[model samples]
Target: MANGLDFFSIGGADAHDGARAVHAWHVIRWLLCGWSLLVIPAFYGELTSTSQGALTIARSLYLCMFAGFALCLLWMLHTSRKPKAWLAHNRLDVTIMIGAAFSAGWGAPPWQTVEWVLRLLFVGLVAIRIVLSLKVFFAPNRLIGLLIAGAGVLAMAGAGFLWLEPRVHNYADGLWLAFESSATVGYGDIAPTTPASRVFAVFVVLLGYGMLSLVFASIAAAFIGKEERALRHEMHRDIKHLNAEIVQLRAELHALRESLTPSSDAITDAEALHSVPRDHH
Candidate 1:
């Protein structure tokens, strides 16, 4: 029963509530976006750092981002009339935030099996949030923008592979591997050998499939939309033509009636002649 405006708006009905909700929504969305972007560098630092100081700084940055994200969620919940409903509506967000916090808090040997698993989970959650945010904020007409964003994400993932995968010597090789994995091409020229790289490949494949599907869908939509527009134009033209012909026919019918029938003036003169007394006798 929700109208488009209401659906898009965070506040349900009240204008004042809606205005506050809108602001909160924007803040939260932007914060989430910033946090998602920062994750790459923060995670890279954690993974690549040799010094304890560098690792601590990276972890601190990540923790700060998580705190900001949590605070945003709290603000959003506070803005809503029904906190429980809001929580229900955004269970995934809440769950991911909780899981991420837990993962970040659980300290393990850096780059070890457990650490890698946690990292994977955190990265996957961030990716999911990015996709979800895109879906919520962007319209289908923004497919081109989404495509560009996808390319950026792909590039970042490639870079991630360059660092995470030992076999990937250069950015180009990592990018090639990412493309191959995402497209499910698996060219066999380069492959992920390590457990971490393989896990990363899995994420790449999933992301690739989603992005490729979106690309195909957008293309198909474009073609279908073009056809629809053409059909609509043809229909409008035909209707207009028919209407003009109808008007012409009406005008012609009126002219034909005038020619076939006696005019008022002529009928009056004919009545006058018939009224002549001598003529009648």
Candidate 2:
């Protein structure tokens, strides 16, 4: 994960409209987030019901959209003057694209399995990119919520697999097994007998731990940061109040000193009267 501060280092262009143009571009890129979220779910829902021709078309559309996003990121990376900054910003994106390409090209097992993996890659990559790109827009709590949602998605997948497997008794059993396995609780009430189920368990465990850690860390950071900010603000206010009070006290002290001091005008008049008396004597 990139440090939060690194995000701010991406400074603006020199032109007057450069920042605006970049903002517009980012907004347009952000639209990919909506598109990916909507279309990926629709693709999954239609997977079983749609004809092969329709499925192919939907997949093709997905590929095109994914390609567009990748291309835009590539352009950004290429145009950036600072190579390190570009790499720091885009490394994750590049990783996702590379992983997807590798999966599509070299993934083994049945074609259906390959396709499903691709679908997952598409959803996961897009979801992550959306979160990262719009990090400023989302609160840490919301980001943690997204992490939980991702975990839920993973759990659901595991449950589906467990239920579909012949060894698994029922849906409830599958759900329990998935939850336990993912949580690393290892109740051992339900165990994966086959190699395939065991393999699935491994995936669930890894993803589960990852999501849990991310959620916990995010929540802690958010609350701690909020408290620190509040404390800092209160301290600043208190300091300002103290300073004002000190200023007011100084002003009052000056006023009091002035009143206590004999008036210059009165002293001058008294001296003049004395001088006149001496003349009469």
TM-score of each: 0.71, 0.53
Per-residue lDDT tens digits of candidate 2, residues 18-111?
4544554465456545544544433442343236565555555555555755775655545545546555654555555555344333423333
Model 2, position 167: C-alpha lDDT score: 68
Error of 2 at 78 (Å): 9.9
lDDT per residue as tens, model 1, 1-281: 54544322223223344677666776677676676666666666666677888777777777777787789788887886767766655655665567556645556445677767677777776776776666753455557876886788689888978988888999999889988999999779999886557767887899888777777777788889999999999999999999999999999999999899998999999999999878454
lDDT of 2 at 139: 50
Model 1: residues with Cα > 4 Å off, grouped in runs: 1-17, 37-55, 107-123, 136-147, 245-281
Cα lDDT, model 2, residue 65: 54
Error of 2 at 192 (Å): 4.0
Residue 37 lDDT (model 2)? 54
Q: Model 2, which residues run further than 4 Å from truth?
A: 1-17, 28-68, 74-88, 110-151, 163-166, 193-200, 210-248, 270-281
